[model samples]
Target: MAAPSPTDHKNRKLLGRLSLPESRFIADALRAETVGGVLLLVAAIAALLWANIPAISDSYASVRSFHIGPASLGLDLSLQHWAADGLLAVFFFVAGIELKRELVAGDLRDPRAAALPVIAALCGMAAPALVYALVNVAGDGSMDGWAVPTATDIAFALAVLAVIGTSLPSALRAFLLTLAVVDDLFAILIIAVFFTSEIDFLALGGALVGLALFWFLLRRGVRGWYIYVPLALAVWGLMYNSGVHATIAGVAMGLMLRCTRREGERTSPGEHIEHLVRPVSAGLAVPLFALFSAGVSLSDEAIAQVFTRPETLGVVLGLVVGKAVGIFGGTWLAARFTKAELNEDLAWPDVLAVATLAGIGFTVSLLIGELAFAGDATLADEVKAAVLFGSLIAAVIACVLLKLRDRRYRALTEAEERDEDRDGIPDIYEEGNPEYHLRMAKIYEDRAAEHRRRAQKAAAAALQSAAGSTTEADRPA
Candidate 1:
């Protein structure tokens, strides 16, 4: 055989670069998010079961009443309620962080790249609301739940994707995730505005002042949360009292950090401060929020009530059916409008499957349901039922559709790639062609890494579709 051609050498190098080393950090992160999600699910189910057991009712009451908080705040909350209120705020902050990342560098970065997901997300939101409202238009006030099924749970969705493995084209998975992230941005906006109560002008003013100061500090090149952290707390308190949700503050807090120079002459004080607080938000705040908010007293008695409860039914149906129509239909319409383009790497079947998967709105759905009906105990109960009910349905739908879609799509895509490179120096992987393997490995590794980061950021945001009072900030006026 003639000496390996230059093209062959090129292919080997590329493949080598593409191969992924199993970094402990990545593996740990995957476990952190995956296990964390699973734990929340289990804890929630356990709570629901335990609360209903006659012997555990009193114990459940005790559990709910148990308080948790940092001593410094001179505060401790009723365990159950605190989970909904206090710990959730940190969850919101993390949501904001993830949202910021998406807008800056991830799925939402390029308008063209973002089109399919954006459209799908919008469709997901509108279709669910319309369908829910149409189903419950009796002026019975069940309309409050129009927002219920519109959210997607990012972590849970990704977990589903993991199970499906190489069956689904990576591109489709990414597109669906990006769509979910954008949908979450809208959901956050809706909660801050529509679901909120009356506002306190003074508190609103303080939030504005905080915003102004934050902008000024950014302009002045201040990156430290020194002045900002306290302001965030004050904003949260004010917003909480202002009739606006508090968690909006988390994003407001992050907005300042987003302004930090991507590439500075040196370092950023404020950005560093924000970074230090991030783990607090992620590790402590979010977990606590999950434990607290995920609880539902799923007694048989409650089960009977859910069928008659609009909020409960609305949430359940919306998540299951609404999400499917909205996400799938919207993506189809958008792609058709945009030159029939999906992700360059994905096909329509793949898109639909991923959209189905996007319907699994667990974490975010739970969080928002709590916020949307916070003060009303009866309503909160109904909302809880809806959340659990809707999320359960959505998860099932996602798992089934994704399983089927990926299987067909992956095989088709692989065959097409093969046809594209049937000649000598064939596709990225040909046994006996070391160069090709190296090149293929590099492409897969680089693209996959970048793609994953964006998807994860979007995913992190998507998980907060249910992010309600778990943060502090003035909702936009």
Candidate 2:
């Protein structure tokens, strides 16, 4: 047989890798997102701390001023805001694309599945803004920070779940994720509408035209990332100049990209594009933004500043108090008044704990704060102070609450593990393992198959009992 072509060889290699079990791959992806997000957060906090120190603060201002864009093209921007505003737009844009995908083809498509999160998210947004306004005694001028608490940081929140262990149920985990995705959509919208300044109509028109051309190419079955990248940059530059918040560029570009992974429509290299760009978006795009935006000028009086200003108080209160009230209370009210129901396995306390964790608003809050108080240094600094304080408080409170809950529920698992120890099997699966470790995980799976069969039988008998009861009641009536 002839040797496979280079492209074919690559495809075969990809297929072989994919044949390495999907669950393991997904688990690894989650692990990476979790660990990486935490690491970036740590770096961001360090930058903030270092930037605030007496002498070190002076060095940061200089470090951030180094320009990287084309001096020849006269497009140079401050490297500080460039990473945060310019590149992080790619992150938001990728986020927007994912949001679109979820709405069109993923969990958000089903009315039953989407309804709860959508409604809860709306309440989640509205309640927090109202709460924030009430606390800040906000007027139109100071009201610019209203949307600060509206986001749900997925990786950070999910990391809390991972730490909580068995205190949370799988259903609760699923609910929070879906709800957060919805929350992200709302936050993006708030950014687009509220944070945008003024528009350059001609430039915007040109960007729209570029977007149209991109869509046309996508429709024509173009599968090249090269086509999308230049156009995407054009879109960002135009939007940046047009006062539309440049990160919206990623959204438009993603809408132009095709995700035709189903049967017999021409396959696009969207995944390949992502394989190239996601690292750039994740490793560089988000982290760089965090590094720049997270540099808060903290003094010895940083702690005291928390309750001093209205904007600072608004941010801190909105996230710590507003998030818990909005997410959990909204969720509870939805379940009570509407036809929505809580996940079967999730306790109300766990739900509340997860919602508290959702208040960990580090990334999007910083992004919005940057936009809202663009030129107002004092306001921006206050906002950053609030964000750091709120995020830290929420993270600590959520972790402690979930830890207590986990300890309460861990008795059975602890007992079972002890039994296993007596029987001489090693406790190798303490926290988690690498993807390779799961290749030999068939024994537990085989036992699960038998358990599932028994479960099906039990469900059948329960269903029959309910049906017979219904029949008897109808006959008597």
Candidate 3:
């Protein structure tokens, strides 16, 4: 790597002056996601170590299998179940909010623009599932996990891309984000429809009523946690009893929140909530679940079984081979069928790299694996092994591909970042157009003037309030 120039060091110092939220946007949320992925990976690694070590494995197993919660309410679940069903609800809630925002007002709102990712996501899901089913067709009930490898863990994939593809195209990042969002929506639906069994209509109805009341409260601008918290729990519990995954309740409630900005708010309530809770979900909830869920013992016998079993092989192949072919081929087919061209900034090779990265199906993949082989502990462990193996392979392949194209990507990133006038627009766009530069400058000036006006108005209000207080004091005297 080249040594940093003096200008680069100065730029870093300048960036240090930005506030936390400002730094987040400047870093484009990539840093946060990457950090979260690192934490999650660490937690999973810790779990694997704890489960494999003879001294620690017993304690690990005991803690994971221990029951908790109110038994009377049929809510007494193992620690692993709590991690999978309870904590992951928070993660899904944030996903729901993002999905709603995208559908209502973001990129997915436009049909033509959304077509590419939506189509790619659908095919990306279908191909892996088909592959898994084919691979396990002769196996005994292992085909139940066909959906296991279909998911794309956005954080893990993004983290890998962040570390290796620092100079990758922004368009490719956006495409991956959109595709993953859609992929998650599909995964949720699959869980709801295929995984759920024996629904209790009474509890389901109660959940519906609670969700309705929650939506009403939100519409009435009731932002009180006291009001929402108990109601949310009620909905989640009801959904749990109703035999649907309780996490779906979170998604439902998130979708219910208003996505468009309301009067006097800088951003929508949904966006605000997501911004507040995403750190909790990414940093704590998901990582904790990973720790609880990823504790597979990789004993010699288990390792041999993982290779020998058709189901385990299916998951591995589905994630590593199925995902790459599905994602890349899906994108190609989507573009061809829609008569849409790839983003001008993204090449087919870049798409291939991203598709390979998408194969890192860690979080949701494990969850599905657990649910799929819930009847047999041995199969469940095998599934976990397969997921870890497959995801690691995917990460390795993606790293190599991304590194191969790193130089081209680096040059592109540099050109994009070059802004000689420092007007918030890349210099390339403003190079030939003095008028465009002036227009941008005027916009910034007008925004500054508006801020000044708001500040003056606030000062005047403070002065009036002070005078009124003085008058009240004189009257009392």
List TM-score per model, in order.
0.71, 0.76, 0.84
Q: Candidate 1 local accuracy as lDDT?
A: 0.60
Model 3, C-alpha of 4: deviation from truth (Å) = 32
For model 3 the local lDDT of residue 471 reads 92
Off by over 4 Å in 3: 1-27, 138-141, 163-165, 428-433, 436-477
Against the correct fold, how does model 1 do in TM-score? 0.71
Model 2 lDDT tens row, 87-187: 87777766665565555544466565565568767877787687778876743337778888777676666555555554343234445656777887778
- Model 1 bad stretches (over 4 Å): 1-35, 65-77, 138-141, 160-168, 223-228, 259-282, 342-347, 405-477
Instruction: Give RMSD (Å) of candidate 2 vs. truth.
Output: 16.0
Q: Runs in model 2 with CA error above 4 Å?
A: 1-29, 71-74, 138-141, 159-168, 264-272, 407-477
RMSD of each: 19.5, 16.0, 15.5
lDDT (Cα atoms) of all candidates against the true structure = 0.60, 0.67, 0.80
Best-to-worst ranking by lDDT: 3, 2, 1
Ranking of models by TM-score = 3, 2, 1
lDDT of 1 at 28: 32
Q: Roughly what TM-score does model 2 have, to 2 decimal places?
A: 0.76
